[model samples]
Target: MAYISVLKLILSVYCFFTLFILCSTAPELCNFPAIFNFGDSNSDTGGFSAALFSLPPPYGQTFFHMPAGRYSDGRLIIDFIAESLNLPHLQAYLDSLESNFTHGANFATSASTIRLPNRVLPCGSGFSPFYLNVQYGQFHQFKSRADFIRTRGDIFGSLLPREEDYLRALYTFDIGQNDLGEGFFRNKTIKQVYASIPDIINQFTVDVTNIYWVGARSFWIHNTGPVGCLPYILTTFKTAGKDSAGCAKAYNEVAKYFNLKLKEAIGQLRKELPSSAFTYVDVYSVKYSLFTHPKKYGFELPLVACCGYGGKYNYNNEVTCGYTLKMKNGSEIVVGACEKPWKRVNWDGIHYTEAANKFVFNKISTGAFSDPPRPLKQSCFNPS
Candidate 1:
């Protein structure tokens, strides 16, 4: 009996070792050694709040003890990507007001637009006339990212030189959601917005091509998220019906159209810049999966936000999650909190909670970041 048991134990051990080796030796998805980010609040580690101090509450209350300017409770997608790459979280360009930039930098502003800026507006304030033209001109004048790199090179020359090979570094972009949400969707029809997508995509392509010129070879681009499902839009705006099903469908269709065009654009970029490595991370698909498969992903709530109050979709952006608001009629609007805050998908109207962000990071690491033509192709690391 003892001899038979020993044989079985040895067999199990051998099988475990074999499986581990096979999994470890799987094909790589991306070959990115370092990561740099450029986008809006979705990936802004602390840029907006660093420049302006009027940011809302519960912004960075998840991972960081205090508000780190991130729109989420914890880390954003960039933070997860950096952690997956075995690198420290990429510092915000503004947050690095006193830090070194040896690893990477994030130049995403809260309300930065990829489209040309015609006028300058306060961050988070809706776009005004000439917003695109003015911002685009400013983007060009500052030589934007290049200027940032040069400044960093000048400052951190002793630590990390400019000539050092960053060709293998991954550059991730997560913008355009704000553009659609704050611009076209707020004012124009879906058809009108869809018509302008080509121009918007073309402008982005130009900007990305410029980044390639500046030594960014590997790229991970994220398409727009599901704008229709956002709490702010559903609660504030009167869509087709009660559950916001119609509004979500319409918005998602536009997003899908944009993503399709974006894919083609990336394909063109690959042909145009053969030496550069590019991959598109489908933020829309991932976010949709989270909403549709909340139970599968261990999420308890999918529709309502963990934060906010009043009604089903009435999210309180100005007040903290547990605070009470006084209406004009002298009646108090009491806001209720979710039982398990971490289990809820959304923290506020539009942003995800820390747990959701972590789950999203995991999905990206396993799905997109570990698939063919990804930016980081070696091995996937769990976000810290």
Candidate 2:
């Protein structure tokens, strides 16, 4: 009798553990009808490309086998999110009007800032839109158009974003890095630049509110990663020797300061919008974790950029990655993609390679890094 009772208890524990494991890894358990994203180079599907000529070689070589306007060698974090949702790659809002929008649209652009910078040049060259506010306006235009043919036979002749579709879509934001990046370009010390973080966050909260009012009840917000860890930053801020991970000390601290405030603001937003589900992702810590344990994330080099020119970290002001440069000696020098892009973490000194992005997305999907502490698959789960 005692032996039989022990077996029953063991079976019950086994069943519970199996159920927990299934819930943790089953991203398909929850369905997200669509996903809409906004940010800078970190998530831009092709916003910069649509506004300008197509990106040069080595930019999208990893996945697209050609330049698709992404800053990285391949997919961005937003791409991973779309894939997880079982949707086609999100099209850029600026893409051709005929482009498919069944999965939603990407409004991110390279060099975009959450707020306008002291100079607009960094906002993307020519008619290219890169400010978060401008991206929102582009979204407004796309929403107004009823030209999009959904996979299902639903017509959008109604109001922009059609109430039902907007309610079902997942909204994501990955901006604010360019705001801090601009601070560095203007030669502001950490102390001086840190002062602006509050205003930056204030604008972000306001934007979230506006988006919330627009019927977007589900939001996934990514905090800025460790900027000091980027090869470009190390090249510029070489004041102190590299930390144990080959990152700059002061620059990383500034990033941490911004992340702390951002997290607090998200909590406040949760309080203000009780009906909305806001998941704050700790991207900074996740990226840093990969930097510390590169092998675990399938990276052999975390500090050295895969495509760059000159110096220890291979980053320079004149010639960045994926661009061909004309030299004074009458020769064209092309800095292309690395032989093993998947083995490296940083791509072109700023963006991440596809492999690194996949790892980060997988980590976030596990629900371990979220603010409210639910898996990403559950973001769209509606509880009565």
Cα-based TM-score, every candidate: 0.78, 0.87
The residue-by-residue lDDT of candidate 1 on 1-384, one tens digit each, is 999999999999999999999989866555455566778777877766676543555556667856677877677778877887777877755664665556766677666667854334554545422222333343344234544566664554533313433566777788777666655545777788888789888988888887777667777778877777777666655553433333367777777888888888988998898776667777777787777778888886676777777567657557545467888999986554465768888877777787887877777665463224343444322122
Q: Candidate 2 — which residues are off by over 4 angstroms?
A: 1-29, 122-128, 147-162, 381-383
User: For model 2, what is the error of residue 105's alpha carbon versus the real structure, in angstroms, after optimal superposition?
Assistant: 0.9
RMSD of each: 6.2, 4.1
| Candidate maximizing TM-score | 2
Write candidate 2's Cα lDDT for 1-384 as tens digits.
999999999999999999999988764455677788989889988887887556788888889998887888889888888888788888887777556676677888877888866666433422234687777776666665544533344554431244367777899999888888888768887788899999999988887887777667889999999898898888877775567887887788888889999999999998998888889999999999878889976688788889888888888867888677788999998987678998999889988999889889988887899987888888863655
Winning candidate number (lDDT): 2
Computed on alpha carbons, the lDDT of every model, listed in order, comes to 0.67, 0.81
Shift of residue 384 alpha carbon in model 2, Å = 1.0
Q: Number of backbone collisions per candidate, in order?
A: 20, 0
Model 2, position 174: C-alpha lDDT score: 94
